[model samples]
Target: MTTPELGLPMAVPAQGLPAAVRIYEVGARDGLQNEKGTVPTEVKAEFIHRLADAGLTTIEATSFVHPKWVPQLADAEQLFPRVSELPVALPVLVPNERGLDRALALGARQVAVFASATESFAKANLNRTLDESLAMFEPVVNRAKTEGRHVRGYISMSFGDPWEGAVPIPQVVRVCRALLDMGCDELSLGDTIGVATAGHVRALLSALNEAGVPTHTLGVHFHDTYGQALANTLAALQHGITTVDASAGGLGGCPYAKSATGNLATEDLVWMLRGLGIDTGVDLDRLITTSVWMAEQLGRPSPSRTVRALSHKE
Candidate 1:
C-alpha cells in the first residue's frame, strides 16, 4: 500500500479564530497508552522524532505512571532519553509526586497531571474520589511549579460520563478552578466519552470563563466516538482557545473509560485549521506520512478521515 501525496486545504480565514494554534501531540503517550501490545521503545522514540520533523512543536513523550497500571508505556525510562534531544516541548504524564519525581529525574521539563470532572471517572480512572484526586494532585502541581517546570492539568469527562451521563457545567468549572488554583499553568478539558456536542462545548467554555478560568489557560481534548470532535473544536476556537490535544493516526482512547474512542486526529485537526487559515506550524504531508507509517507498524488502517482520504484508502 503506497501512501499518496496529500493536497493542501484552501485558506479561508474565519473571524474570531486565533492567529495560530499550538497542537499538543499526544500519540506517543496518551495515544500509545491504551494499546493492547507494547510498542517497542525505539519505535516510540522514532515516532516522536518524526512528529517533530513534521513541525509539531509540542509532543507528549510518555507517561511516568507505574507499569502495573499502564504497561504499554512502562518503557518511559528508556523512551524519554531517546528523544529528549528533539527541539520541542516533550511533556510526560505524571500521576502523583512519585511519577513527578520519575519524570524530573529524566529531565522532563513539562509534566501533566490527570484529573476527572465527574465523581465516577475519578473513582474508575484514578481509584480515588473527585476531591481526593485533587488533593493528590495539589502537591504534584505545586512541586512541579516550584521546580520551575510547566504543569498541565487534564480534567477528564468534562462534557459527559458513561456512568454519570450529561455532566453539569458548574461541576466541571469547580474542577478547572481547583487545578488552576493549585498552580497548574494550563488545563486540557477532555470530552472523555466523546459525548459532547457543539452547544455543550460552548456552554462549558462559557461557564469556565465566567468562573474566572481564562480561555488562554485552557485547551481542548476531544474524542471522536460520537463524530463530534471537529464541531466541538470549532466551538472552542470561536471561544478563543488556541491549544488543542490530538493523537497521531487517531490512535488513543481512555483505558478506564471503555466507551471512549480514538482522540481527534492531528491530521484531521490540521486540515480544518489550514482551511480556516489558522496557522498550526504543522506540515500536513509529513504528518500524514508519519501516521500512515505508524498504522503500518500497528498492522491496521488509520481511523483518521484525513489520513484515509489522503492515502486513498477510503
Candidate 2:
C-alpha cells in the first residue's frame, strides 16, 4: 500500500500506536438539516456555542447551499459570521462555487465540499454526475486554499447507495483520490444510507490506503441504519483514523435511504470511547443536556441509547 503523503500529522498517531480520537459534532448542521420544523438562527448559534462548551473542537456549523434545498440553514450569511468568531474550529458546507463565495465572504476559515460515490445519488442530491460534482468543487478548493482556508471533501454514500446497491471499492477509491488530488485537506467517508458494516469499512479503508489515500486524512460519517455505526467506527479506529463525525442525539437521516436514520449519537460514541479508556475531552453530561434541549425543541425523542438510558436513571 502506497502511504498517503499526509503533509501534516495523521489525525491518528503513528501507525501501530493507539491514539486519542477527535469527534466532529454535526448536530448543528446535519442534524438540524433533517428536522421537520425549522430551527431559528439564534437557536442554531446557541446550539453551536453549547457544543463548543462541551469540548468539541470541530463542529459542522451550517451549509451555504440553496435555501430551497435546506431551509433549516437559510441564514448562512448570518450564521457563518456568528460562528467564525468562536474559538472552536467550525467548518461549513459549500455545495459549489456559489456557496463557496458566500462562505468566503463571511471569512470562513474552513469549509467542506460534498461529492458522492454513486452517480444516481449524486445527480439527485447535487443535480450533477460524480465528475460534474467534483469538477464544481475545483474552483472552490483552489480559492479556499489561496485564501488559507481549510477544505474538506465529503464522499457521500461511501459504503452503499440507496439507488446504486453496493458501491464498487475501486470506484470509491477513485472518487476519494480525485477529491484529494483537487486539494481537499481531508476527505470524509459518509455512509449516507446507513448500510455500512464493519467488514465493509475495513475493506474500503484498506483499499483506499493501498491506493495512496492517507488513513489520517480520512474521517468516517456513519448512520445507524443497521445498527452498525459505532462498530464500523471502531474498525476505522483499528486502521489509524481519529476523526469521526457524529450528531448529538443521533439527529439526521438520508432523504434517499428507505427506513434510514441519523448518524451515530455523539453521546453514545463518547460512552463507547470512555469505556475503552480513551480520552475525548467531551463532557458527556453536558452533551446529554444539549441533546435533550435540541430534542425538546424539535419535538422528537432522541435516538441515542446512552441518552435514553441516562435519562431513565435521572
Candidate 3:
C-alpha cells in the first residue's frame, strides 16, 4: 500500500518525519510516591510491567530517598528485584550519593538526579540551597559515571514555583547547563506547579537550544495543574524534544507545594501524540486499561482525562 502524504509535523532532510518519541514513564515512582495512601509492592511491580508493555522505552521504577520522606515507595529495593525483566530502560531517582549507593546495590543501570531552579524549592524539597543541592549532585553524578550508569537530571520549577513565582530563564538555563556539563545523559525541565504557558515553554526551550544545548538532550515534565500540560508538550515537540516525562493516570504531586498537582497523564499524552500522527509505540487502549486498574488499586478516580473518558465507554 502506498503511504499517505502528510506534512504538518515537518520532515528532516535525513530523518524524514520523526515518527517515534521516547516516553519515560514515571508512574511507579513519581505517580505513586505522592499518593495519600500506600500502594502494595506487588501492585507497583504490576504497574511497571504494564507501562513496559505499553511500549514505554524508559520507566522510572522507583526512588531511593529516605522512607520517611516518601513512605509510599519504601519498598523500592524489594519491588525492583521482583519486576519482570524487559528490553526497555528502567531508571530510578536517587537524591544523593547515599541514595545512589542503594540504587547501585540493587543493580540499577540507569538513574536520575534532581535539583531545583529556585532556592526555596531546594530548601523545602531537599533541605538545601540551590548551590548546595547542585554541589551534592556533583558527587552523585560522578559516582554514577564511575559505575557505568546513565544519569538523567531534573530541574524542578523551571517555569514557576509556588514560593517563587515565574522562575527566570537564566536560572533554568544555568541549572540545565550544569546538569549537562556534569555528564548527565539528558535533562528534564519540570513545570513543577503547572503554571507555565506554551509561550513560556517555547521561549525557555529556544533560549537553551540557542545556547548550544541540543534539543534531543532535553525532555519536558509538565504538571496539569493549569490544564496546560499538553500544550506545553506540543511546544516542546516543536522545539525538537524527543522525550517526555509522564505518569499513568496523572498520579503524584508535590507534598511541599500544595498548589502543585498531578504530572501530565501518560494516557492523555499518548492520545494527543497519536492524534498528531506521532508514533510513541505505546498502545493507548492498554495504557488506559492500566490507568483504570491503577486507579482502582489506589481506591480513587484517575486524574487522567483519557482514562476517565475511555473507562466510561467500556
Please name the candidate that would achieve the greatest lDDT relative to the true structure.
1
- Candidates' lDDT values, in order? 0.93, 0.86, 0.86
TM-score of 2: 0.93
**What's the CA error at residue 141 for candidate 3, in Å?**
0.2
- Which portions of model 2 miss their true places by more than 4 Å? 1-17, 256-259
What lDDT score goes with residue 225 in model 1? 97
Candidate 3, 104-192: lDDT as tens digits: 99889999997899999999999998999999999899889989999999999999988888999988999899889888988999998
The C-alpha RMSD in Å for every predicted model, in order, reads 3.1, 6.6, 3.7
lDDT of 2 by residue, 56-95 (tens): 9999999999999888789989887777778989999998
lDDT of 1 by residue, 32-141 (tens): 89888778988998899999999999999999999999999899999998999999999999999999999999999999999999999999888899999999999999
Q: Is candidate 1 or candidate 3 better by lDDT?
A: 1
Clashing pairs in 2: none
Q: Is candidate 1 or candidate 2 better by lDDT?
A: 1
Write down the TM-score for model 3: 0.93
Q: What is the lDDT ranking, best to worst?
A: 1, 3, 2
- In candidate 2, what residue range of length 10 has the lowest lDDT sum? 1-10
